[model samples]
Target: MRELTTDGLLDAVRAWVVIESPTNDAEGVNRVADHAGTLLRGIGASIERMPGRDGYGDILVGRVAGEVNGPGLLLLGHMDTVHQRGVFGYRVEGDRAYGPGIYDMKGGNAMAVAALQHLHATGRRPRLPISVMMIPDEEVGSPSSRAAIEAEALRHRAALVFEPSGEGGKFTVGRHGIARWHLRTEGRPAHAGAYHAEGRSAVREMAHHILALESLTDHPRNFYVNIGIINGGTHENMVPAECSAICYALVPTAAEEAELRAAIHALPQHDPDVRTAVTAGLGRPPFAKTPAIQALYNYAAMLAAEAGLPSAGERVAGGGSDGNFTGALGVPTLDGLGVIGGGPHTREEYIELACLVPRTRMLARLFETLGPGVAGL
Candidate 1:
C-alpha cells in the first residue's frame, strides 16, 4: 500500500471540509458524497449510491473486494455536519486545521480514504472483504440511514466508526442512546384579563410535564433528561391554547431505555381540561460493550502501542452515533477511531496535524491485522 503523507491527508480533509454538508441540506451532503465516490472509484472500489429517504441525501457504500468471500470489515462514517452554510469554513493555521466539520467527521472520513488507498496500493489484497459506508444524515440521528447501516453491519464481521475520538484520544467503548420526545398540549384559549380563570393554559400544563421529565434524570446511572426546546403562547393577553415541548433523554442501557420509554408513555396529564399528546421520535439505542467489542479494543490498543501513538483507552461517550445501531445488533463495534480534536458541532472545531500520520498508520495496521486468521484472538 502507498504511504499516506501528511500533505496528502491535509489536502483530502480540506477537499471534504469545504463542502459544507449540514444534516438538513440534502444537496450539500450529496456534494461530499459524490466527491468521496469519485475518490473511491479512482482506487478501483465499486461505488453504489443509494437514494436517501425522508429528505436526506444519498448514502454511499464503496466496496473493495477481498480475496476471500468471508465476513468483511466495515468502515462507517457520516457525511453530514450540524453547522449551517457559512457558519464555519475550512482554513489551515499552522499545525491545526479549522472548519465546521473537520473535527467532527471530515478528518475521519479523509483518514479512511487514505487508509484504503494504502490497503489497495500495496497490491497485497485483504484476507476478508472490506467496505466503507458513509451515510448522509448522522447529525440528525441517522433517521434516513439507520436501516442501511444495520443491513451493512450485518454483512460485516466487525465495524469501526469514524466519530471523533473523546477528549484525551480515547476510543468509544460505550455510548448512550438518544430519545427525543415531543409533547403537545391543547386547551381553550381565553383573554387573560377578561377570563383568566376560564382557560386551562396549555403552557402551564406543559411546564408540569417538563418538570416531571427533568425529574427522571439519574446522574449516578448516567441517564439524563433535558427539555431543550419549547414553543407556546400566542400573546401575553391570551391564555395559550397550544403548547409543544421537545425533550432529549439519554439512556445508558437497553433496560434503562425501556424503563424511560414506559415512563414517557405513562406521563400523566397535568390539567384536566387540557388534552395532551406525547410522541417519541428519532432514537438510537445505546452502544454497550460486549466481549467481542472489548476484545477488538484490546487488539486496537496493542496496534496503537506498536505504532508509537498514545495509548487509546476505553471511553463511554454521552453522544450518540451510527455505532449505536451496529452495537445494538450484537455486532462487534469499535468507535471513535477517527481524528483527534475537540469542539464538535461548534465553531472551534479543528484537528491536530501531529496526529494525522500516526492515526492513519494505526488504521492501516488495524485492517491488515484483523483480516483472515492473522490475529486469531
Candidate 2:
C-alpha cells in the first residue's frame, strides 16, 4: 500500500504532453512511441514495437510478468491525437496542461506509465500478468489497430482502457459501437442551359438519401446517425454526374447494430433518374455493461474505497474506444480509468491537476490489490 507522489506524476505528465502525436502524422506518433518504450523499459517491463501500415505509426507493447501465469490483463491507450501540426498548441498554465491530446489520451498514457513506475519502485508484483499495448489511430476509429487489439484481448482475461475519464472521473462501463460509411449516387451529365430536361442531378438524389439517413435516429433505442460530410457537383453550369457523402451511425448494443445496419441498407433507391449505392458495416461493436464487467468495476471500487478515494459503481453509455475492440471478443472490458476532464477534441481540452495524483494512486492500489492469485482463474 505505497503512495505515489503528486510531484513525480506531474513531471511525467509534463514530459508526455510535450510530444505531439497526431494520428495522421506517422513521424510524430512514432516519436511518442519511442519515448514510451524508453520509459517502460526503465520500469523493468519488456518492450516490443509492432510496425503499422506502410505510412502509419508503430504500436508499443510493454509487459510486466508475474510469478504465476494465467489470463493477463491488457492496458490499452492510443498515442494519437486529432490535432494537426501547429494546431491546438500545447501549454501548461499552473497545474493544468492544455494541449490537443492532453485530456483525450496523452494524460492517460502518462498515468498508466506512472502507475507501473510506482509498482516498480516499491518492488510490488501484481496477482496477474499485466500487459500494456499503446497503439496509434484510435482518434480515427482505430482502423490500423483493431485486429491486434482483438487478438490481445482474446489472449487476456480483461482489459482496462485509458481513454480520459468521464467529465468527473467516472469510469465508463459501456460505449456505443460505431459504423461509418460513404454513399454515392450517379446520374447522366448534360448542359443545364441547352438540355436541362435530358440530365438527372446526382446531388438531388444524394439529398434524398441524406434525409432518409437522418430519419434512422427516430428510433428511441439510443441510435444516432449523421451525414457528416457531403461533396458533389464540379461546376455550377453543367448537371453533375456524381455525388458522394460520408455518414456515421452509433449503436448502443449488438442487436441494435444489426437493426441499424439493415435499416441503412434498406434505404429506398426511389430516384429513378439517379442510381444510389450505400456502403456500411461494423466499425466497432458496442461495448455493453455485462455482469463480468460489473465484477471488475466492483473490485476496483472496493480498492479505491480502501485507499480513501471516492468509489462508485460502473457507469455505461454510448461512446467508442479500444474497449470496443476488446469487448467485441467477449473479454471483460472497462474504460475511462484515466484522469477526469472535458473538452476532448477542442482547444479547451484539459485534465484536472488535482485528479492526476489520486487517479494514479487508485490505479496503483488496484494493481496491488489484484496481485497474483488474489482473483483465482
Candidate 3:
C-alpha cells in the first residue's frame, strides 16, 4: 500500500486552513470549493460546480471512474465554519495546526483528496465509482443545502462524511436528533411614562417563553433546549413591540425530539395582549444506529486494523452533520472520517497534525475496498 506521510498531508492541506470560509461568507466558501474543485480536476475527475443558493457558496460535485459499476461511494464534506473570517488565524505549533475550519472540516476534505491521490498513485480504483460533494452550509444545519445533500446521498450505496475524527479516532456511527426554531413575540408599543398600564411588553413575553424552553431540558434523558440568539426592545423608556430569538433543541431519540417539539408549540400565553409564534429554520432527524450501520462500522474496523492504523471504536455524537441527513435516510454512513482534532466551533480549534496520513491511508483503503468487501451494506 502507498503511504501519504503526515508532513506531506499537512502540506497538501495547508492552503485550505489559510482560507477562512465562514458559513455566511458565500464568496469565501466558494473559494475553498474552487480549490477543492481544482484538486479534484487535476486527478482527472469529472466535476460540476453548482451555484450558491440562499446566500451560501457554490457546491462542488466530482466523480472519479471506478473499476466496476455499483451505487458508488459518496465523499461528503463542507467548507463552512461557524467562525467569522479572521476570528482564527492559521498557525502550526508542534503537531497542532490551528485554524477556523481545519478541525471541523477542511482538513477532512483535504485528507479525502489525498486518499483519492493515493488511489491514483496505486493504479487502482474501487469496485464502485467515487463521487465527491462539498457544500457550503453544514455549520448552520444545512439550511440551504439539505435537499441537495439528501438527493446526492440517495444516488450512492454508502456515504463517508469527513467532519472530524472523534477523540482517539473513534468512528461516529450515529448523531443526536437536532432542530432550531425562530421564536417571535409581538405586542402593542406604548410610552413607558404615560401608557405603560395599557401596553404589554413583547420582551417580557419572550422572557417567559425562553424560561419555558429552558425548563424543557431534561439532563437525565439527554434532552436539552437553549435559546442562543436573542433580540428585542428598541429603547428603554418606551415599551417595545417586537422580540425575537433563535431556539435550539437536542435529543438522542426520536421520541424525545417529538416531546421537545410539542413543548415548544405548547408554550402558554403569559399576557393575553402579546402574540407569539415559532417557525422552523433548520434541523436533522435522529440518525439512529441500526443493523446495517453497525455492519458497515464493523467492516471499517477490520479495514483499519489491516491498514495498520489505531483500533477503531463506534460512537454516537451529540452534534449533527450532513451525515445525519444520509444516516437518517437509512444509507450506510460513517462520519468523523477527517483529521483528528479538538475544540470545534471555537478560536482554539486545531487538528492533531500527525494523525493525518494514517487516517488518510485507512480512508483510502476503505474507498478501494468497501463496495466489494462489505456485505449487506
Candidate 4:
C-alpha cells in the first residue's frame, strides 16, 4: 500500500468534515457514502451499499482480502453526526480543525481510509482479510445499523471501533448500558380563576415523577438517570391537563440495568386522579471488558510502544457506541482507536491535529499484528 503523508491525511479529513451528514438527513449521508466509496474503490477494495431504513441513509461496507484468510478483523465506525447541516463551520486554526463532526468521527473515518490506502499501496498482505463497516445512524443509537454490525461482528474474529479516545488518549474498554423512556401524565383541566379547587394538575403529578426518577441516580454504583426533556402546562390561567417527559438511564452492570428498569416501570401513581403512561424506547446493551478484549488491549499497547507512542491506557466511557452491540454479542472488541480529541456533540468539537498521523499508524500496525492467529494470546 502507498503511504499517506500527514498533509494527505489532513486534507482527507477536511474534505469529509465539510460534507455535513447528519443522522436524519439521508441525502446528506449518502453524499458522504459516495465519497467514502470512491476512496475505497481507489484501493481496489470491494464495496457494497445496503439500502437504509425509511429515515436513514445507506450503510457502506468495504472488503479487502488478505493473502491467507478465514474469519478476518473488522474495522467499525459510523458516518452520521448529531449536528444539522450548516450549523457549524469547518475551518482549521493552528493544530485543530473546528467543525460539527470533526472530533466525534469524521476524522477517525478519514484515518481508517488512509490506513487502508497505505496498506494497499505498500502491497502488505494482512494475516487475515479486513472488513470496514461504516454505517449510518450511530449518533441516534444505531437503530437501523445494529443488525448489520452484529452480523459482520459474528463473522469476524475481533472488532476495532473508531470512536474518539478518552482523556489523555486512553482507549475505551467499556461503555454504559443505555435505555430511554417516554412518559405522559394526564389530568382534568379546569379554569384556574373559576374552579381552581376542582382541577387536578398533571404538571404537578409529573413533577413528582421526575423527582422520583432523578432519585434513582447512584453514581457510586455507576447507576444514573436523567429527566432530559419535559413539557407541561398550556397557558398561565388554565390548570394543565397534560404533561410529557423524555428520560434516559445508564447502568454499569446487567443487574443495575434490570434494577433501573424495574424502578421506572414500578413508579407509583403520584395522584390517583391523574393517569400516567410509560413507554420504553430503544436501548443498547453495555460493552464490558472480557478476557479476549483485554488480550487485544495488551497487544495494542505493545504495538503502541513499538510505534513510539505513550503507554496506552483503557477507559470506561459513559456514552454508548456501535461497539456496545458487537461487545455484547461476545465479540472481542476494542474501541477509541481514533484521533485523540474532545468536546463531542458541541460547538467546540475538534481533534488534535498532531495525533492524526501517529494514531493512524498505530491502528494500521495493530491491524497487522492482531489479525487472527498473529497475536496467539
**Model 2 TM-score, 2 decimals:** 0.94
Sort the candidates on TM-score, descending order: 1, 4, 3, 2
Q: Looking at candidate 2, what is the lDDT of residue 294? A: 80
Superior by lDDT: candidate 1 or candidate 2 = 1
- For candidate 2, write residues 1-377 as lDDT tens digits: 13566667767877777788788789999999999999889877899899979477999999988656887889999998888777867676786778878888888989988887888878877657889899988888887888888888899888988888774767888888888878899998999899988889999888888998778784577888889999999889889889999888887777767876777688777668798887863388887777777877877777667656676445765677889888777788878888777888888888878887778887877765664434332
Pull out the clashing pairs in model 2.
Answer: 126-371, 126-372, 127-371, 127-372, 176-318, 176-319
Cα lDDT tens digits for candidate 4, 48-76 = 99988969999999887876678888889
Candidates ranked by lDDT: 1, 3, 4, 2
Estimate TM-scores for all models: 0.97, 0.94, 0.95, 0.96
Query: Which prediction has more favorable lDDT, 2 or 4?
Result: 4
lDDT score at residue 68, model 3, on the 0-100 scale: 79
Using lDDT as the measure, which candidate wins?
A: 1
Supply the TM-score for candidate 1: 0.97
Q: Which tens-of-lDDT digit does each residue in 1-377 have in candidate 1?
A: 28678887898889999999999899999999999999899779899899988899999999887777878998899999999999768888898989989998999999988887888788655556789899999998888889989999998898889998887678998888988889999999999998999988999998988888899899999989899999999999999999999989899988878887788788798788999998888899988888888988888889888877888899988899999999989888999999998878789899999888888888887876686654342
Residue 79, candidate 1: how far off, in angstroms? 0.5
Candidate 1 pairs with clashing backbones:
1-122
Cα RMSD for candidates in order: 1.4, 2.0, 1.7, 1.5
Question: Lowest summed lDDT over 10 consecutive residues: which window, candidate 1?
Answer: 368-377
